[model samples]
Target: MTDDQRPGEFELIERYFAPLAGPGGLDLRDDAGLLRPGRGYEVVVTADALVAGVHFFPDDPPAAIGWKALAVNLSDLAAKGAKPDGFVLTIALPRDWTEAWLKDFAAGLGTLAGQAGCPLIGGDTVSTAGPLTLSVTAFGTVPAGRMVRRAGARPGDVVLVSGTIGDGALGLAVHGPDRPGWVAALDDEQRRFLADRYLHPQPRIALAEALQRHASAAMDVSDGLVGDLAKLLKASGIGAEIDLDSVPLSAPARAALMADPALAELAWTGGDDYEILCTASERDYSALIAAAAERGVPLAPIGRIVPEADAVRYSGKGGGQGFARGSFSHF
Candidate 1:
């Protein structure tokens, strides 16, 4: 390419990068992004990345990708009951990414940060020889001795989940291949609901903070409920009994699972739900819900922690109850 035809990185950033970087907050021309936390605040840091085919689909929208990339990291902080301070983003762009695509991506990222009261601090951008990837590191702070940990669950603590579950997994089912049973019965709108869930999962940051204020144990439901809850129980050195009928599936999910009994296991094993599963004393449950409601968030009671004889158990319909064994696992 001729000298004039070559795209300068700075010029490319200004033309496409600055706008999406969020409204007039950061100076894209600076050597580094700026981050300023208020006095007396201690920062907590967390990071996560999504590979195009691995974490998300190739057809996923730029805005949703940007929103979710930040949301997932924020969810971690929320589980710790932290206040978001800011975030940094690193993007591995495909060689052919148009200026418009970058602009949209930046805009999407900016919008999420602005609304969440977290600023985009700084990050790197590089050309990727392979599929697109986004990495975001989020920062936050909380009062001393206020952060919740997974290891705090006491036996007899009531287990709770924020919002419904299984929607995202159902969303994947609708978009991907039809499994032997449940996926086939979904109508177009039902399929769309599931697909949207898979594409867009809201982070439970605010809810996490609320839970930390009152919960003995707290975790985000990134993996299936049974799986993630089991992790929390293991961390707390406790065991739990989750009523299968009380697993809190959405209407679609309930209907779908009802259609294929085998898929009930899939619902428990599927990952990427992004809700919050927590445990609190029965005395604290109302308070937890009240705090969440003050922030306009929803919380629900689903199960309870028991002695550690078995890791987890499930009691389904028709007087059925048994061990869960495990949930969505990489191995």
Candidate 2:
């Protein structure tokens, strides 16, 4: 359809998005969103962009696509020990866009948005000749002086990761067109478990408060654990030695690994796991673990910060591992 027949941007937004708007969004009629700063609290903001066939499969479910666009940013907020507040969204649709697609996407997004207590604030809409693109800039609040950062870790701090790693990575493998022969070892439930993990990221929002009380330095393992941990350590001007055997794994990932032990590399190095990777002082480590366990999130200790500056050593079959391009880089 030509531009003349297409619905106005405002009409589309009001129909599919305005209902998701948070406070100060002015029902999408205002020039800007206003989020008054809470007394004694600070705001944390993070953004992530996803493009068709880049961040996600072009044929992926529209709802999953919508959920992921925001989840990734929320993961960032979680790493910073922030709680959901509100967010702005930007979407660039290709020529073949439709109202039905937007409807389903909004439903998918609203499902998680409501669950997470994050709301849409305001944003821009436009047409693009390129692939479908979506971006979310999310805002969250943490008590003043309590927001977590990636530079506070010191020597002797223990490295801990929440939940299992590699599930999302294995999920990606199952979703790929060239499905690995090891896929045969996984049952239908295992396949679904891995695939769903890839489609929906479980941001450790519940563990945010615990992290604030215990974590010295933290960041979500959006890339690979090893690479992201390296980044965190570099920020703190420290190093670490991790036991690869201790890296957490889900049932499906373990099954796949058992079928093909070599998949350990992909499981350990492939990105998409949104779990929180953090460092905590050994003294506060128990509190952190207890907090995570209370929230029903598994906390695994994989390594410890060392005095050697900027060194990352791992012991396991994955020893001497090196990423060709160093984790998932859109660039």
Candidate 3:
């Protein structure tokens, strides 16, 4: 299009986003998406938003921001053992919009959408005087009555987590303004590793099928292990005893903790891990581990569910530790 014929919002949708639209999206020319789940399948819907100085750094790359906005929501669906189907995106842009930034952001979002087998359906865009905000509502499908939930954990069930914890939290410590002094001990490679974890979290979508087959209760850990686990336990009407020593840690996080043991609390409570925290019967735990391993995803048994209601106990070599704050809070 010529400069004088520059596309407006609707035209922009056709030019840039329409290509990513699925059948339900009606080529982005409809008032709303038309989702039709197959027989014996239920739709799983999850939404997450990233804000300029809140969910992510304001100066972070637009592409990374786009990936994270979609990935966080996908993580939720993964926990529920759902298969990606489609999504809707709503963006609030600053008054001064740049085509280059939009192009990069859409590319990042579209790439992941395609990879996950989820297509863009419909959404809205608007101008905002405040910070840029991107919201995504992703849709998925799960077999009827098989969706995993946070309320199915029972006493004697094993608590497990996929991949390492604390990496995302540590990554934030490396780049956040209030970073601990100990972050200085990290070398360039270590810093980059942690920062990348913070910038790009890998959603464990590959293990959803295994989760449905084995996990009794499941949730994606976004608000720190300690707090998110507590939420899960409460929902299940039970309690847990977590071994602080067994909470998985990435190599970079381990090195940082070795530099300053005090960093352990931050690692546990700092949030943004995006790993799956699940509970399964001891009889099924081994099979679940094997299944996840077959897919090249590591599932670590960290603790066990207890009969005590609504209580989370922590124990390790240093004795018991408590957190003044359990998880990340927007308020």
Candidate 4:
């Protein structure tokens, strides 16, 4: 089509996003969305931003980027034990934006939105000179006074995490320019497994109900187990002795570590694993495990909360070790 026939920002929204809008979206014609929590429920809101070069490679597929942008936000809601309701997206794009890219991105976003039962509400779009950026503010709901908090762990609470860790970080290494020589030791299937984990994180929304029932404190493991756990400890006024060896690792991560034991530290400190990390009392642990198992999600107990205040230590087969870095930091 000629320049005059090309779709503008508003036109694109109506064409690609309006259909995905739910009851509160008002057909993309309104300035803001209208959302009301269900009776006896409170709204839980969280926002996350992704920059093209910073959060993802510039050459990554638009669809994957779309899924990730929303998935990360959903992960936050999952940590709070809230059921997702809706989200608003704001995107700043380079001048050369094309209809094809937007179409695929919208498709990806819509698929996850439908699966999570969270529909798009409303958002802003604009042109930018720098890298593409997408921000999503997601809303969820939990029974009044039932939303989980980071500061609820008690001294005797057991530290547990959903699913295996380290896959996302290892996946990044495999996709990076200077991937370690040990990566070559991994088979083709193993390589793809790691890479896929990096591109698409499976938010543990299925475990939210169980977490609300049993967890004393909870948070998603976006930054790194070591560092994020430290944050939880600080918030809950306790310490933890994480059994580094017991920290769950995916098969691919395990294979890579076996090839190069040094990769163990990277597995511990590398970030981007969006699994839920939580603390629950021993009495509730069995029930939590049963609940998660029914949802086909694994719950691994990695450590226990301690009486000491604000300390996180790692102990492996050879005693204690120090991580080069605790977690990913942009600044």
Candidate 2, lDDT over the whole model: 0.87
Cα deviation of 36, candidate 3, in Å:
2.4
lDDT of each: 0.75, 0.87, 0.87, 0.88
lDDT of 3 by residue, 206-244 (tens): 989999999999999999888899899889999887787
Off by over 4 Å in 4: 1-5, 22-25, 327-331
Q: Flag the better candidate by lDDT, 1 or 3.
A: 3
Colliding residue pairs in candidate 4:
none
**lDDT score for candidate 1 against the true structure:** 0.75
- Ordered from best to worst lDDT, the candidate numbers read 4, 2, 3, 1
TM-score of each predicted structure versus truth: 0.87, 0.95, 0.94, 0.95
Better of 2 and 3 by TM-score: 2
**Which pairs of residues have clashing backbones in candidate 3?**
none
